[model samples]
Target: MNYKLIVVMLFLVMGALVEGKRLANLGHKLKQEAEKVGKEAGHILEGKVAQKAADVVFNAVLRKG
Candidate 1:
């Protein structure tokens, strides 16, 4: 009876550990996707700002440098 209880407990603990690992993996994947989206957004905003800056500087210069 004691041995049976021990075996059941081990299985329960293992199942819980596996579930935790799966949750962690899902969270990691979501974070990676979010970071990728953030990077793309940053690039788009940077491109717009760079273009505007170039236009401003070009207008300021009396002659092309």
Candidate 2:
């Protein structure tokens, strides 16, 4: 009976370890994807800001002329 209990405990520990590893891997993948998306969003925002700045400058120049 003691040996059976030990075997059961071992299996449970191994299963838990495997599950933990899987969750860690999934978290890593999600983080990478979020970073990629963040970079793309940053680039898009930068472009928009630049365009708006240019428009403001162009309008200012036209008004002066």
Candidate 3:
């Protein structure tokens, strides 16, 4: 009976370890995806800002002439 209990405990511990590792991997994947999305958004925003600045400069030059 004692041996059986020990075996059961060991299995439970092993299972918990496997589950923890799986969760860690999932968290890492989610973090990487979030970073990728952030970078893409930043690039799009930068382009829009640059275009707006160019337009403003162009209009100013035209008005002066």
The list of candidate 1 runs beyond 4 A from truth reads: 58-65
Model 2: CA > 4 A from native: none
lDDT of each: 0.97, 0.99, 0.99
Instruction: Write one digit per residue (lDDT tens) for candidate 1, span 1-65.
Output: 69999999999999999999999999999999999999999999999999999999988895765
Error of 2 at 14 (Å): 0.3
RMSD of 2: 1.1
Alpha-carbon shift of residue 46 in model 3 (angstroms):
0.7
TM-score of each: 0.68, 0.93, 0.88
Candidate 2 lDDT (Cα, whole model)?
0.99
Quick one: best TM-score, which candidate?
Answer: 2
> What TM-score would candidate 2 get against the native?
0.93
Q: Over the stretch 1-65, how does candidate 2's per-residue lDDT look in tens digits?
A: 69999999999999999999999999999999999999999999999999999999999999999
User: What tens-digit string does per-residue lDDT give for candidate 3 at 1-65?
Assistant: 69999999999999999999999999999999999999999999999999999999999999999
Regarding lDDT, does 1 or 2 come out ahead?
A: 2
